[model samples]
Target: MASLSHLNQQLLSTNTLPFTPLNSTPSISPPTIGFRSKSFGRPIVASADVSRRVVYVHAVTSDDEWGPDRDVPYAGVAVAVEEKPVETETDKLKKALVDSFYGTDRGLKASSETRAEIVELISQLEAKNPTPAPTDALTLLNGKWILVYTSFAGLFPLLSSGTLPLVKVEEISQTIDSEAFTVQNSVRFAGPLTTTSISTNAKFEVRSPKRVQIKFDEGIIGTPQLTDSLEIPENVEFLGQRIDLTPFKGILTSVQNTASSVVRTISNQPPLKFPISNNKAQSWLLTTYLDEELRISRGDGGGVFVLIKEGSSLLTNQRN
Candidate 1:
C-alpha cells in the first residue's frame, strides 16, 4: 500500500494526466460521480430483467473501409493481389494501451509511468474519436461491453483490496439492451469458495448527441457460482520479481477438494436485490468515442472508461 501510494504521488508530481479530463471540451461537463464499484451494494428488481430478455449475439464486420486487407488475385493484376498491412495511428495506440495494462491489474497495479502512458494514449484516442456524438449511433451500443481501461478511482480500491482479503475481481462489464432502452453494469468477484457479482440496472435517457442520463433503478447481489476448477497461474511478478506458485500448489489443491458441498448450497439460492437511491445513483455519461467494437466515455466529473464490445478483435488481439 505504501509503495502504491508513493508511486501515485510521484506520478502526480510529474504528470497531470488522469486527474484532468482527457481532451475535455467546453460543451461537456465533468461528471459529479464516478463509475460504481464496491459501493453499489444490495439488489432490487431490475428494470429490464436481462435474465429473461434475450441479448442476441451476432458476428460483426469491420466498420472501417479497409476490411482487413485481404488479397484477391486476377491473373493480370499480380501486384495488386499482394496482401497489405495497413495500420492506423489509432491501431497502434490501441495496442499500446492494451500492452500497458499487461500487469496493471486494471489500473490497480499500474505504475506511475504506466499510468501516464495510459492517460496520454486515452487523450490521443479521444481526439480522433470517429463518432464524437455517440448517442447518434445507437445500434452500436446494443451488446455487452468489457471494460479494459478506466481512470475512475472508485474501482481502483475495489480492484486492489477486493471484497475480501483473498477475493479478486474477475471482470467488470456493462450490458446495454438498446431495444429495451436499458443498461446494466456488473462487477464479478472471485473467491476460494465461489464466484459472485454485484450489479446495477438502469434506464437511460438520451439527452444529447453525445450524452446520456442514466437513472439507476435497481441493484443486485448476484448468486454465487461454484468454480469449475482451481486454476492458478504458473507464477506472478511481485515488486519487480517473479515468484513461482509451484510451492503453493498443494495448498490450493487441498482447498479445491473441499469446495463441493458448501459451494453447491450457495449456488442454488437466488440473487438478492434492492432499489437504487435515485439521487446518488444517477449520473451523466458523455461518449467521446464510439465504433463497432470500441467505446470511450467520460463521466460528469471526467472519469474515463474505455470498453470493448464482447466479440471485438480488440479483446482477441495479441499484446506485448
Candidate 2:
C-alpha cells in the first residue's frame, strides 16, 4: 500500500479522496482534512468515516512549508484521498464576519443604538444649562462704581478676629477697603458694590428657606472693631424678610475700577439626594432674576459665577 502521507500529496493534485476511519483507533477516527488555499480564505473539511479505517486530511503550515509529508501505514493506519470542496464569496464573507465579532469579543455583534440613546440621554441630564434671569442689566450698568463681589483675597487678617461693626453709610464705589462691611437681614453687605465686589471675604450659609446667615470679615466693614452679626440689622434695609440672592442668568454690565474681567456666576445644582435625571430636565427648573453683576473665575476645582449686586433677588418659580 502507498504511504498515507504520499497518498495525501497525490490527493492534493488529483483533488479526489474517500472518507474512512483509522485502523488502530477505530474509536479514534481518521483525521478529517481541511483545505485552505491562499485564494480560499475559509475551507470546510468533511468528517472521517470511522468504519473504513482510511481517510484524507489537508492542512497548511508555514513552518512545514508543505502539507502532510507522506501518510504511512504505521500503527494500523488506513488512508483514503478525497476532493476538497470550494467555498463561495458569500460563504467566505459570512464566515469572516462571524469570526470577527460573533462568539469572541471581536466577533460581529448586535447594534448599539440603544446604548447610544442612553448615552445621549445621560449627556442631556449632565448638560450645562444657562439660568434664565428675570431681567438683563445691560441697560442698568454703565460707569464707574464700587465693585463688590465674593472675595478671592481670603479673610482680612483682623476681620475674623472678633465682632465687626456697621458703619455710617459710605459712598458706593470701586474702592471700599476691607474694613467696611454692614450686615442686614442676616446677609453681610460688602463695599465697592458696583458691577463687581472683590477682596472682602464674604461667606453665608443657607440654614433654611426662611433663614440665611451671612458673615463678613471685621476689617471689611470699615469699622472692624464693633461689627457684629447682631447689630447688622440696624444698618441695612430689608431686615425682616427672607432673602434669596442666587443668580439664574445675566451678563456683567461694568466693573468699578478693576481691569476688564468676566462676570461671576452662581449655579443651582440640586442635591443628588433630589434624584434628578435627563427624563426630568424641565422639572428641575432654576429660575431667577439677573439684574446684577456676576463674577466668573477659573481654577483647579472649576469655574464659578458670583452674583455681585448691592441689592438683588433670585426666586425659584415652580415648573409647569
Candidate 3:
C-alpha cells in the first residue's frame, strides 16, 4: 500500500488529478482502491478499475495539511486557506463615525445612532490620547475644511427645502506667536429659481489649543455674477432674507498696501486693509476626532459643527 503523503505528491505532480472550481460540485468516478484506516474512516482512490480489494493502512499523513481525499472538497478547503484581517472595536467605531459624514451634504442632521456612536468614539479616543499642547494646535487646524454636518440651527435655514448647497470653509490658523487668525467662507446656493454665491472673511484669535474666538470684523455677502449658461432669478432670498449683490461689489475687495500695521494682521502677509467691527467675537471649542480628516467643534452657544477635509477637486468643481 502506498503512503498517503507519497500518494498526495504523486497526485500533485501528475496533472491528471481532478480539480473542481471553487464552489462547484465534484464529479465522483468509480473508486478502484478503498483504503480504510482506524484513524481516518475511509479514503477514496480513483483509478481505471473498480474491482480492486480493500487495503487496510496503519500510517496516515499529517493532520493539518490535507483531509481524507475523496473528490477534492472545494467548499471547506477554499475558505480555510484564505485569511482575513481581524477588525478591532476601535477601528469599527471609527469607521462608523466616518460613514456617518462621508459624502453627506452640508446642513444634513445625523441619525441618533450615528450621533451616539460618534460621541462614544470621541470619548474613547480622547481618553486614550489627551489633547496636544496649545502650541501644536495651529499645525493641525491650518488646512481648508469642507462642512459635513452642523448642529447649529442657523445653518439649516440656508438649505431651501430639499436642495444641497455647497459650503467651503478656509480655517483660522495661527502659530504660537501669531496674534491674529483669518477664516474665509464661500457658500453657493442653487435653488429652482435662483443661483447665488456668498463669500465672507473673518479675523479671529486662538485662545488655546482647544479654543478659538472668531470676530466677524469684515465680510462680503452677495450674489455672484452668473455666466452665459446660468442666470439668476428676478427675486432671490438667502437665509430667509432678500439678497442685493449691488452693494457688496466692493465690500471686501483686496488692495495692496505698503503699511507695516496691515502686514501684522494677515497670516499670508498680503497687504490689505481689514476694518474692525463693533460685533462681538464668538468662541468655539474644537475637538479633533480624526487627524487631518475629521473635526467636531462646539460654539459658545452649544451648537456643534462637523468638518471634513476637502480635496482640490472640490474647489475646482465649485461654480464661480
Candidate 4:
C-alpha cells in the first residue's frame, strides 16, 4: 500500500444526471492511482478526476485523503456567484457616442480626429438599430429632441462667433407632433436679459420606410422674452473667447426696472410668422438610428445629425 489516502465519493448508478457544473472553469489535479498487492497479482485500479462544463464537483481531491479500496465520494457544492447586470451592445455604443460629445461644443469644436471617431461610432450604432422604419414609428418620435451633435456645416454660423458674443446659443431642438404630422425646428438665443427664438414650422410626409419629405411652410422670429433677471456677469465666454461685460453690469442694473417693463411689453405681442417661399426650405431626412433616448439621422446634404431625447441622462450629464 503506497500510503493509503482518504477519498470521498458516492456510488452512483450511471442513470441519473451527474451534476450541474459550476458557472466557471476550474483547475483540477491528476487522478490518484492505487497498486494492488503484488502477491495477489491483481491489476492496479486508478480513479480519475471528473469535470463538467461550468461546474466543479468535489471528487476526492481535498487535503483529507481516503483509502484507494473505498468507492469515490461525490458531493455538489453551492457556489454563491455574484451576477452582474448586463448592458446590451446598443447601450454600450450609445454610451460611447454620448461620451464622445463631452467637450466638442456640439461638434463645433471637434477636430478631424474627433470627427472621424464620432462618425465611426455613429456607423456602429446605426448598424445595431433596433427600430426599423423610424418614420412609421410615430409614437416613438412624438416628443421634442435636443440637438447634441451634428456634422452639418450649415448650422456652423449659429454656433460660432457669428451670433456675436453678447448673445449665446441657448438651444437647438426639433419638436414633432405625430398626430398632426407636423414638425417644428427651433433655435433659441439668449441675451443679457431677454431670450429670443427663430423657428420653422414644417409639414412632413413619409415618402419611404426611412425617409421623410419636409416642406417648411412658415418661419417665426419669436419676440424676445424677458426671462432672466438683470444680472451682469464678471465675464462671458463664447467659442473659447471671454470678454469683460462687468462695465455694463452696473449701468444695466441701475436701469433694469425700466428695461424689464419694456421687454415684457414687447414680449407680450405674438411672434412674427412669415410664409417660406424659398425653394431651399424643403429637405428630406433619413433616420439611421433611434432608441428611446437617442437618435441619429442623415440629411439630404450628406451631413449626420445626432439628437438626444429631451430629459435623458445624456443631457443631464452634459449639464452637470
lDDT of 4 by residue, 1-320 (tens): 33222121221222132332222232444322222221122222222233211222233322322333334344543222334558888888888888888778788889999898999999899888888889879888889999988889988877895258678888999999999999999999887777889999999999998899999999999987875356566888988999888778767786887887787689779999999998888999899888889989999988899998998987787630
In the range 1-320, model 1's lDDT, one tens digit per residue, is: 23323433443354322222112222333331111111122111111112222221111111222133122211111111223467989888877777777776667667789889888888898898888777877888889999887778977777775645778788889999888889999999887757889999999999999899999999999998887567788899999999999999999788777676657777788999999875878889988888788888888866888888998788886232
* C-alpha RMSD of each candidate structure in angstroms: 25.9, 27.8, 15.2, 10.6
Off by more than 4 A, model 2: 1-153, 156-158, 161-305, 314-320
RMSD of 2: 27.8
Quality of model 3 by C-alpha lDDT? 0.47
Question: Which has the higher lDDT value, candidate number 2 or candidate number 3?
Answer: 3
Backbone N/Cα/C clashes per model: 10, 59, 0, 15
Ranking by TM-score: 4, 1, 3, 2
Candidate 1 similarity to native, TM-score: 0.63
- Model 2 over residues 1-320: C-alpha lDDT tens digits? 35545544544454344532222223343444333243143222233554443344433221233243233221212346454557654334323322222221110121365334423332332232222321132233222222221122222222232233432222223221212222221222343232111233333343332222335432222212211112112222366865432241122222221222211211122212212233322111111212233212212222111223443221111010
Cα error of candidate 3 at position 301, Å: 1.7
Q: Report lDDT (Cα) of residue 28, candidate 4.
A: 44
TM of each candidate vs. truth: 0.63, 0.16, 0.46, 0.68
Could you tell me the lDDT of residue 122 within candidate 3? 57
After superposing candidate 4, which stretches have Cα over 4 Å from the reference?
1-85, 161-163, 232-253
Better of 1 and 2 by lDDT: 1
| Evaluation by lDDT, superior candidate among 1 and 4 | 4
lDDT of each: 0.69, 0.28, 0.47, 0.73
User: What does the lDDT read for residue 199 in candidate 1?
Assistant: 97
77 Cα displacement, candidate 4 (Å): 24
